[model samples]
Target: MEKHSTLAQPDTLASAHRTFATEIAALQALDARLDDSFEQAVAMMLACQGRVVVTGIGKSGHIAKKIAATLASTGTPAFFMHGAEAIHGDLGMLTRQDIVLALSYSGAAHELLTVLSVVRRLGARLIALTGHAQSELARNADLHLDAHVAQEACPLNLAPTASTTAALVLGDALAVACLEARGFSREDFARSHPGGALGRRLLTRVRDVMRQGEALPIVHLDTPVADALVEMSTKGMGMTIVIDDNKQPAGIFTDGDLRRLIARHGDIRPLTVATGMTPGPKTIAPDALAVEAATVMDAGRLNQMLVVDDTGLLLGALHMHDLLAAKVI
Candidate 1:
């Protein structure tokens, strides 16, 4: 349990809210400044045949890592390189075809500049995100984005706050611009992320894992009730497809149907498969994505789905457990 302190508030509390609003306002202003340089940065990345190498120092390094992740997820291959490590042995990660995106609030990070000469000699183009256009980093960069801010969120006006926000917004702007110009599709995005919820929604198709052939627990509509139960138990899918003499699905019989029949009629051996079966069970298309199948299954228990073509001929059946095991959910 927390000991609630009943302390009187100071006048500075109101000023703190004002500070947050002010920083947010700075971000809005920076959003409006997203222009050609943002497009140029995207173009530079699109033209590169090699990976994008991102480098920064201090708090800017954290922002740089996030920007790199956004780029990688959006179809641009990118990775962050520590500024100091580049002086050690990580500079070998850079190729001449790659582009360097450097971040420094003051447009000058001592460690980032350590390899500036080598990067230039290797003919790699530089795109810098910084506040000072005249600072060393900006002057040396091939393209510079102006992420200037009038004040910091800190009361002392020294800590990086509005500046960091501006840089983050600018990085997002660049990545999205590139994402659009490259015609990055949802399928492509899913290909890069086969682990995320969005990826599961886009990539997993039904045919990829649906149970087909003899694996489907099925029986003729006129098959004995005793035989149908045996088939369902053998397949372990909790249901069986009811097909007619023409080999077309007539209906379905599930554990629920059996329970209801036992409750209503109290049958011992008089009923047959057609007597208690549910005709025209819910079905799904083979081309449907696993995500869509999940939705159908979620609507109810949907133990199994009958896959069919346009003409409605039975193709196969799929189980909800199959989808779960495949990690399609």
Candidate 2:
């Protein structure tokens, strides 16, 4: 039992090391072989006015699905097709305007090749990522990328190993190139993934979430300290705007101001709203993004701020608590 336990862990570690080494060597070979064909593949994808169809067999098929997803999420439309299914009715998914990306470590996966005739008939541009340029898939493809590796990490040198890693990296290269070509932006990505927290953080606008109009806790610049305190308490936002007769924001009265004035004067009534008000308060536009408002608040070192219209008229108020409760932070 002792010998068996000792042998098992070391065997697993050795197999892992061999696998990593083989995959690294395969990526190195693929890196060395990058040439104009890669450029042509990107150009073919860029020219496609339709989706990109990714296909493979076995482990390659799993990798192909991931590649397809990445492409779709990053501004390029893409879908995965099982190579064997293409021989069935799935070939109908392909259109002349689309581009086909084929994957095969040996460059001769039979299931993948079964659709070569249909690919030509569909007139879809073909780009092959393979380990052998002379293989049937490469020979038939309109563009070919070399995915060669010196050896497999397997004891028998038969596992997919390095070849699959090389294929995946090459696929990533294609996706990123197309992503940049299309000028994909964070906003675009957010639209593709609106359900995630990141999407809300980036895409949610201030107008969508900010308090507005009469909901704002506001006091006129002429308001007495007692009345201003009433505004703050009733609004429950911890602060209130003090506006001039023209309805433009003249100052802001906060809980901090009330505390300081009481400590100094010992009488809240004798201090008018203007006396306790801060002359210049940080402000935001109602149309700004919620994340941007959070950034502005943090940068100014304040917990609460006033929201205004583009022409400087007071529109609403926001507190750091609003952001925290909305999970914008």
RMSD of each: 3.8, 2.8
TM-score winner among the candidates?
2
Of the candidates shown, which would achieve the greatest lDDT relative to the real structure?
1
How do the residues 15-96 of candidate 1 rate in per-residue lDDT, one tens digit apiece?
Answer: 8897888789888887777788877778889988988888887889888889999999998899999888887998888988
Error of 1 at 274 (Å): 3.1
Q: Residue 9 CA error for candidate 2 (Å)?
A: 4.6
Which pairs clash inside model 2?
A: none
Each prediction's whole-model lDDT (CA): 0.85, 0.85
